[model samples]
Target: MPPAVEARPRDVRGYPVPAITPWEGGEPRFALTDHGRSADCARQRRCSVCDVPMPPGPVWRVVGATESAAIAAALASGEPYRNLAPTTEGPGHRACMLYASMVCPYLARPNARRGSSAERPDELTAHVVRGAVRGELGAVVGFGDFEYAVTETQVLFRFLDLVEYLPHDTADTHLAELRAELGRVR
Candidate 1:
């Protein structure tokens, strides 16, 4: 079971708040990250969504299958996958990440874009955004041993060893197919 909606912290709009969500002058900036909180969660091994200590086990992440496949391809080819592709988001508990995917507007809407192309200035950032497939296709729930690292501008997550993956919506057959393809390559 997931945490009760009311039990989680809320933003001004009464939506369950994520630990990395930023606030500007007391208003939630859903599109932005709070770097300080993000770093704390990473260093302390806490859930990015619930801001609680992660249960002992693999950390979970909600990812786009397209991006997962790309990483898998890069890894198989002996490319520097970690440096070439770092997840801007941090890891969370399985339940927390699942719940956030269902409730967060950006994650819940399949066709929504992160922002204009201008917002994604670099090729890597743009490529990452392309992986944000959601809704009927759902998202990939990845379980892995991960560690935290800080770049000059942001905290990054690197999955040291991927132990498992579960598609968020089993009914989304497309996601299952994609996951299977990723399995073949990874």
Candidate 2:
């Protein structure tokens, strides 16, 4: 007689859950809650940022295809989130906030700074924004579209794309001047 095969448990979605096996180091460590893990799975079931759900079952796409390559390039170069800082009494603030909201759902109101002499950290600082996300994620830094969590040791870059808006008159323009300063820390 042939040996019997074991069955797996299914979740609410009717997907089989593989049997939990002990790791070489011992019990597995999970960083996210059950609900959060479910949400992450759901997000992966669809487009990275879109709401539409993908069809059930296995599907494949070329990782470095045109669209994927574009996204990868954008994320790698930080072009998508650059130059979003606001200027005084202008559309820059609104535009930045709007763009940020698309990536970060909990983005707070814009906080402006005048000079480096300020003691408190600038609220509009991207690092501060990243900190808020880290706090909510229980210190885990997961990076995905519409969500972000990264480790302290990980190199994170907040690109402010102001190249187009920057003035061409001077070699040491305001935007160039600010970027030079920010680049040092990263």
Candidate 3:
């Protein structure tokens, strides 16, 4: 008899695929965001911020201690929450949160001094907002923290889309610290 292989991941139609295995080493794990190896996730990209699948294009990546804190608070509160800027959980429309990433206090951190390494120890380095899709507000993440967001809890947003994918090598405005990290390696 042939050895049975791991069951193929099921396509939930709207849900983004979750990683069955985590990054074992310090390399990097893109699964934390919409960047997964699953066929559905690849076939259609969803906005990490709005949870709305969209045409693969340019999306906004949110960062900074404040945004992080808000996410933590939102999860802990366990209430339908909303923000003017992009959320850490998903991709957002460039037109929706683009201006925020460019001006958010924590994002800019003008007064904050650059760390010695220039590389931030706490991030995937980049998030790409790909193509677009117009779908109903399926569901909102439940309760959780920076580690993870609860699935199917809130009813705030409907509609998600894919904008893009940010490889470890590419750095956007959110990755200001790691902007030229690869260049410095040489």
Candidate 4:
């Protein structure tokens, strides 16, 4: 298989690049995510990046303010919650998610917006845009246990005990470290 993913791959910028992330013309498409693999990761309890079993503890999801708010509102409602739902991007190992949040261009930038429907007219892209919080506020790392909730249309992750939310920062320190590494390599 893909080397068992004991250790995940990293891009030049030192970001944890997901195994299922798309590549086009030999260049990685960092903006796009693979929905099939996302579902698989959630089902198998595997790390989205490395495709390995997650270590014991909470699973980590990179979420924006919109998702955070939806989750909070659903929890506050008190009745059985299902509509709040999950993102197509599945939970991953904490380190993997943290590294990605710190260095991935889209996640690191607080104001980066997705391309419009006119630009990317695909169902998956549409889902991504709909699920994404417009980049007005920064992202957060959410940790919890999740179970699949089957709906009439699709299956989604229903998080349990999702008590932790950490701020996702832009990669100033990581970019500086990358630059230093490049200087040494040269």
What Cα-based lDDT does every candidate model obtain? 0.62, 0.25, 0.31, 0.56
Name the weakest run of 10 consecutive residues (lDDT summed) in model 3: 1-10
Candidate 1 local lDDT, 34-91, one digit each (tens):
7788999898998887788876678877665465565556557866444335677788
Q: Candidate 4's residue-wise lDDT over 1-186, tens digit each?
A: 123332555556654457667566655566665556666676778877778887667887666656656655656786433434454566776555655665555576666655433234444235456334345334444555777743443435656666555543463434444345335433
Per-residue lDDT of model 3, residues 1-186, tens digit only: 000111212233422222321233533232233224222222345433233454544444444444344444655687434554323344344432332333322233333322222122223233322221112111112222112232332112222232222222111343443334223422
Pairs in clash, predicted candidate 1? none
Over 1-186, each residue of candidate 2 has an lDDT whose tens digit, in order, gives 000001323344543222221122433221111224334433455321122243443221111122234444565687662323221111112122122222222221122211222122344232332223321111101112222222222211222222222211121223333345335423
The candidates, ranked best first by lDDT, are 1, 4, 3, 2
TM-score of each: 0.69, 0.17, 0.23, 0.61
Q: lDDT at 31 for candidate 2? A: 16
Which stretches of candidate 1 lie above 4 Å from their native place? 68-84, 115-138, 168-186
Top model number, lDDT: 1
- How many residue pairs collide in each prediction? 0, 6, 40, 0
Query: What TM-score would candidate 3 get against the native?
Result: 0.23
Task: Kindly report which residue stretches of model 2 are placed more than 4 angstroms away from their true locations once superposed.
Answer: 1-39, 47-108, 112-186
Q: How far is candidate 1 from the true structure (C-alpha RMSD, Å)?
A: 7.3
